[model samples]
Target: MTLSVQLRHGGPPLDFAADFPDGRITALVGPSGSGKTSILRAIAGLLPVRQAHVALGTEIWAEGNIHRPTRERSIGFVSQHYGLFPHLTVQANVETALIHLPIGERRKRALHCLALAHVEGLERRYPDELSGGQKQRVALARAIARQPQVLLLDEPFSAVDRSTRKRLYIELLRLHEQLAATVLLVTHDLDEAAQLASHLLLLRHGRIVQSGATSEVLTRPTSEEAARLLDIPNIFTARVDGTASGRNLRLRWGPHALRATGPLPAGIEGDLRWAILPSNVLLVRPDKPWGSHLENPLLVIVEEVIEMGTEAVVRLQPQGLSEARLQMRLPVRAVHRYGIAVGREVTVSLRAGDIVPLHTGPAR
Candidate 1:
């Protein structure tokens, strides 16, 4: 399956394009009003595209002049609210979509779909009688009753509680394993996208900011905007001052100078930005003797500590720097072990390999 779309509309332009393979989930994620849902609507034929090309498994679903209607696209779409008929029972809601088949066949298929959705016992319950999770499952069963070639989900689990959402995530994964349909999910939660999707398309201002495998995009973003959008911690602006020992490069940031392991890129000089994840920041004790360390240890004042079960986020500010702060996620036990708290002095080290150079530009 391949989807190539280019849309130009009023306000921020949607110059978005990407290709999704068969039987894999591609998540469309970004901030609110970033056109993530707009792209999904266009793919489902709910919105018109000024210029586009879309295909699914050797069939021409849409092109510049020839556009297929929503029904003809043979896609199953689940909206945020789990759009179900309040008057119809769970069984009847699913059976309605299978009305094209014979009467007995329709009943059999509807029952089978209910079984697949784990809602077989609640077939006679109406939409208002079922819980949020059950209603979502019923809606899903109805959408998949006809066996669509593609499935589009726009924050389908947002209406449910957190625990219910996690359960639905596992259910969706099992359903995908059985059905093997090309799935496109839209969500504003990056953690949800990382947990559920195999590939990710980061959208911003109605355009695709980054697209790649979930692991790659989450770890190694290409630019500063991408890193910021990904919520990467400890982003500092620095300049490549000169070369260091054994092909290492030196960088100057604020009142501190640091060494980078790799050689500087050819023809690159002047100011640059570097980012390190919170998990990569190492903690050192100020009272400990200084060994032959590669980089200088930073003296910082602990500003805040937030405990969240297994881990704690320690916010620190460099002692003499005016506008520099670093965050580290340490184990909860370690926080107490080292006596980390507000207004305490501590030493921290950032390895050269953990720092990645980032380019800056308007995300598109």
Candidate 2:
């Protein structure tokens, strides 16, 4: 069943409407105080909003004067902290969600859920006795114990270590396949959202900046704000210099001229913001001669190289454009092989198709 939500609230004012597809994972991603959690709360009937119209298919959860109670809604919520009861055993915690079932059936269902969550042997242990990952698993068992129609997860893996988080990601995928429940996940990590969610909603200041298929929103953000929120670091101001060959549009950035694949935004005659993904910024290798087929090649001076284990984030300033710096990620081995360091001049290429024209005029 499709989960539809229309909410408007005061205080920090939130206003948005969206329809989450049935049996698909939709991620709500944004910075803090962006109403990711508020949307979840509003759906679960935990938040008192000024106006709300929430429904699963034709069954109304909240509309007009009617508001369904949290427990009545067929949703399972896992909070950032897991929300497992410290005093209860894992089995009892999960059993709490199955209370609507007969007394004898609850235990069996809860145990099955624990097994599905891959925490079968830990049923007797209390939440305090379990590790962070274990607690998260137990929480998942509890959430799915009643076989809810919608799963609401708020930073469910935030407390775990990287390796554990990865394992939990696999487990979540496994459970998702088995349960096939609609999931609304709230996360600050874009990578996590990209990995798990098919649809993504980018929120900022209680408003949805963009919402679309995960890959589309990540690659082709509708606005400069959305690009910035998604952490695309290669944003710069450029003026439309009219059309290039074929479908490419000419752009002038300071003294440098660039080309982007586009029918430029309608009636945009002047300066506009443009951004490219860091992954699209390629560093030309010295051993392998730069290809002539490459698009925008600019000589840049390496200003910073941040080593991130296997990969490095290199910031480069275009030779003559002191005001602009481009960020790109390269393999650590490539960084060492190229001897990429501060003050080193190197060439980087930006493909025409990779350059995305954003909002018109300078950012506010």
Model 1, 76-109: lDDT tens digits are 8898988898888889989888878999999899
How do the residues 1-364 of candidate 2 rate in per-residue lDDT, one tens digit apiece?
9999999888667987899989999999999999999999899999989999999999999999999999989999999999888888999999889878997899899899999999999998888889999999999989988789999999999999999999999999999999999999999999999999999999987878889899988998768888989888888888889875556788888778888995446555688788999889998887886566879888899999999989999999997888898999999999999899998999999888889888643122
Off by over 4 Å in 1: 242-249, 261-267, 285-296
Clashing residue pairs found in predicted model 1: none
Report backbone clashes per prediction: 0, 0
Q: What's the lDDT for all of these models?
A: 0.83, 0.89
Error of 1 at 337 (Å): 1.2
